[model samples]
Target chain A: MGELYRLRRKIEQIIKDGNLDEHQTKGKITLECGLLLALINENTPDEVNALRKLKTAAEKLLGNF
Target chain B: MKMNSLKLKLISLVMACMLANALIIAWLLLDSFQREKNTLAWQALQGAQETYVHLEENCTRTLSATLAALLADEKIAALYQQRDRDKLYRYTAPLFEILKNDFQVTHWYFLEPETAAPAIAQKCFLRVHNAALYGDVVNRVTYKNAVQTKTFSSGKELGKTAFALRVVHPYYHQGTLIGYMELGQEIDEFLSTMQKMTGDAFALIIDKRYLDQTEWKNVRNRKNLPQNWDDMKDAVLINDVLPNKEITRFEGEIEKIPAAGQILEEKQLGKSLYMKGILPVYDAAQRKVGGILILHDITKINSNMKRTLLYSAVSIFVLTLVLGGLIVFVLNRLVFKRLDQMNQTAIRVVGGDYNTKIVPTADDELGQFETLFEQFRNVFVNAVSGIENAESKTIKTKRPVKKRKPRRKP
Candidate 1:
């Protein structure tokens, strides 16, 4: 058991070192796309377009109403 | 979201991605099925409209012909005899004989122009009548727009209310006006035909508030049944969407109420609906006054999907178990096995077991470990050998010096 403990610790240390290298290349820390994607999901589709149209129509109608 | 170690975090992330992908795929499939159900429900409604339109047109044509024939017939003309109080019972008997019996309208009465009192030839009294002047009724009708069923009472137990659309045909003779004929048929069987066509699907003849006026019959799980869907699914019949009326989709979660009419009305929630299909209930002139809402309950579909996911999860668990076994096995063979070998070698070297050497196999990180262990072994063996050699040389040199000192002393 004592011998097993020693070996396990050594192996664990090696794995930690390898993980640090992996994170440097493929970390969530590097990408700036998550927030944008989240934004797109919360709003209704075509609703913005409809509002934009309403705004433009209001402008036109005011010029003529 | 918090993970234990880097390895654990990585594995958990991969597993999370797999679960998310599975969930997304399941959601997409559910959405597609929902769309298909909506389409099917719409087609069924269209089919019902076509059938009724055909039947109504047929009945109208046949009744118009019968009315014409009655006007020309010798027997009816003789009965047009009573001039002082012309009770239209004679006109109605022939109308019933010709229109009601054959054409499927149970109530056929000549609505008088001055008085809307149903002149029943059979009883000479109104059968189902709120008898008033036809002109007054028409004026009220014109004001109200299209004809419809009005709820005389409230709640669920009052059976159903009565309202009728008028079919006005003026009866003229020589140079005088006789009266206007008002034709109305209780559309029970016509609606029944619609119910029949919509097998296993929910069909409703909704009234002014979009509440169901027809008998609630729903099809559930492809089962052939007279499903009493008084309160089946959590749905909302979107009505009052007039061409000019401003209304929203009542964005929110549908309340947990079993009936379809109840709404949660909270803007933050999404309505979990199985289907939403609406078709306008047309007037006799084929005008859109109100519509029928045919909704297919997809709650069972959702539950079945959940069950399918559960099944998929179990299968995925099994697959992952196998994959986990493979990973463990491969790790044991390539990584842990090498590690165990290196561990034993390390134990030997640490235990002062000199001359212990590990033949390096794959040139990996473990190979570097083996190289390190080999160097330690060489240093240990050389240090032990040099100590033994030094001790022997000191003993030999001391013995020769002792012999020379003894000889000189003698």
Candidate 2:
């Protein structure tokens, strides 16, 4: 429960900051980042796997630009 | 000029290529025309020089033949040896009329070898003007040289626009040189004939020393000349200089070729083009005696070339514009339109509409991409529907039901 709460706080902070990368700290939350946050809120192993896949997709999207 | 749409970008690319091609073609066309003009200029100069030589040759041939006829006349030789002036006039009266009126012989003077006085002198024009008609001629030295060698010689007459051929022969009275009889023929008649033959103006430029004589200046004062004739000391314009009536282009950039013995140049004025060539004349002693300037009008050819270039440029510009428009239309309809539709479908699928169908129109790479995207959408739709069904069944199973055994205990 404590780890879940800490992960929720981190996700909220990431969403509020609208950025996940260390150097990138500005801009609105992307659809990919929003999808990742929604998967993390599910709190299930399958959803966590989906979150990991979405994180990879977000990284790929950033790399494309 | 902006790369905003695919249609715009494609049209711009094609138009740019077309414009570049048109410019290159125009440049090549202009270069070819320039080369052609250069070649024509050279040929024109050559033709003018040939015409001048032809005139000179015609004069020489006619004078040579006339001199031969005169030498063959036994009565003239007898009259010269006797120095009979009145009898000589009676003997040569009809022959002189025939020579002057029929043959354009301007001057005829028979010089006696021992004296400076002419044994018999006759002229076509009764003006009694120049010394060539008399014995005090500026080319008397040339005449004496011809007599000494007993050969035919041709030279330009001073104080006149005439080129004279002097043929001095020894009249014999039983194997003795009695006196020298000389014949002189001027060039006005030959020049008029040449002008009639060729449609070009001719000018005979003499040395300044010839025109510097008092008699020559007095004669020139009667003729029409430019106001600055005296200042134009480079080449003395003769009295019979052909007027530049048709020449609209008279730019004073006559190129002087010292080695070629001719000055050749072309000029463009308004819509017309004119070519001028000056062939230098040399005497038998290889001295630069004078020049013959010929003007040829080549305006028709120049205008034809200009019209061709203008037509080609206009045609090319219109063709390029039409071709560029056609290219843009084809690309927009066949390729870009399809691409735009596919993009919209992809955006809808990205917004979670997993049932978005992509209809491919061709077998190219784009078509293959569209097919793969449709398959991905199908799989995503099936997976999402299956997940929803499974979750509903799990929720039904987790719902607690009231136990029936608790009612029996009550």
Best candidate per DockQ, number? 2
Model 2 Cα lDDT, one tens digit per residue, B1-410: 35697677767788889999999999998999877776766665577667666877776677777876877778777776676655666677677778778876656656545433353222111111122243333345555566667666665454344355444454455566555545556655544565676766666666554445455555556665443345454555553335453332222322343425443577555665667666566655555666666666678877788899999999999999888888888787778877877766655544444555888888887788778877876886677566656766765776688776655554
- Docking model 1 quality class: incorrect
Q: Which ten residues in a row have the lowest lDDT in candidate 1 chain B?
A: B150-159
> Tens digits of per-residue lDDT for model 1 on B1-410?
24664445555566676667666766776677556555555555566557656755665565456556655555544444343233545344555655566666554433333322355321222222332322232332311221122111111111123223334344345534344443455544544555565542333333333234343222222345433333223323322221121122322222211222321111211344334444444444333333344444445555676677677667766666666666656655666667667656654443334455777667888888878867776886677566656755665665545344455554
Interface RMSD of each: 25.8, 9.6
Superposition error at B3 for model 1 (Å): 12
Q: Which portions of model 1 miss their true places by more than 4 Å?
A: A1-65, B1-88, B106-137, B140-161, B170-180, B200-307, B363-410
lDDT of 2: 0.58
Cα-lDDT of candidate 1: 0.42
On the 0 to 100 scale, the lDDT of residue B3 in model 2 is 67
Clashing residue pairs found in predicted model 1: B89-B121, B116-B132, B116-B133, B200-B219, B281-B290, B281-B291
| Span of 10 residues, lowest total lDDT, candidate 2 chain B | B120-129
